[model samples]
Target: MDSTIRTAIAAADGDDPYRALRQLHHARIELTRELDRAEALAVRRARTAGASWQVIAMALEVSKQAVHKKYGRG
Candidate 1:
């Protein structure tokens, strides 16, 4: 996996493991939220640049319908 994630897991496994685990969980949640925002921005930019949902879905390894449902305006 990612070196950063590995480091976090290692730190979480050290002394005071419970506190470390909570820290790791919080970090993961923040990272996930950031990723979601980034993805939404990327999808909007792609749409503005004339990319079709089918193309976006292919790149994301998901269905066009799924991509559209998640990122579509209406």
Candidate 2:
């Protein structure tokens, strides 16, 4: 959704439209993985800083049980 990514996709679409869309989808997936990694790191840091699962879950807009299940054992 970023302007830079939009520009890139537009340029790519000018060449081979389908290939450009596929590449953009792949890029979005990769970006999502990176974001997940960053979020996990931040969660770990928050836990270390004495933040509770409920607090983290509230910040993430997810259930506390869900957050705990995801990060509690790991």
Candidate 3:
């Protein structure tokens, strides 16, 4: 997906193992932040399109209460 994530998976390895590990750690943080933003945006769009919290939760594999708590009613 993202170049940083792709690099983490495909290239962040073993020339100098310690340095690669550090780069991978940072990439993981970046990837998690990106994913959180993306998930938030998707939830917004889904809600706009009249999706129920239960439907969204089903798609996300979380409980309805968890999704509602995380995104709230809008």
Candidate 4:
């Protein structure tokens, strides 16, 4: 999360607590989306780095073929 976002949330609370809470909720949702994207990128990169599909699948609790089906080629 960005420090600027935290500051904005803190300021929003000073004006209206409920609105600030809503703002925080929206921020959290966006943050979650961004984190998901980053995680996916990292997984792809790890696979490219020579990590085996079976290893990735085990960490993700899925089958090796399942991981390959989604990200095997690229």
TM-score of each: 0.82, 0.80, 0.81, 0.59
lDDT of 1 at 31: 77
> For candidate 3, what is the total of clashing residue pairs?
0
Comparing 1 and 2 by TM-score, which wins? 1
Tens digits of per-residue lDDT for model 4, 13-72:
587888777777878888888987886797888878988888888888899998788767
Residue pairs in candidate 2 whose N, alpha carbon or C atoms collide under 3 angstroms: none
Expressed as tens digits, the lDDT of each residue in 1-74 for candidate 2 is 36646755776858778777776887687678878999999999999999999999999999999999988986
| Candidate 3 runs further than 4 Å off | 9-12
Candidate scoring better on TM-score of 2 and 3: 3
- Report the number of the highest-TM-score candidate: 1
| Candidate 4: residue 46 lDDT (0-100) | 84
Q: Which candidate gets the maximum lDDT versus the true structure?
A: 3
RMSD of each: 3.2, 3.0, 2.2, 3.6
lDDT of 1 by residue, 11-52 (tens): 876888887787688778777888899889999899999999
List the pairs of residues colliding in candidate 1: none
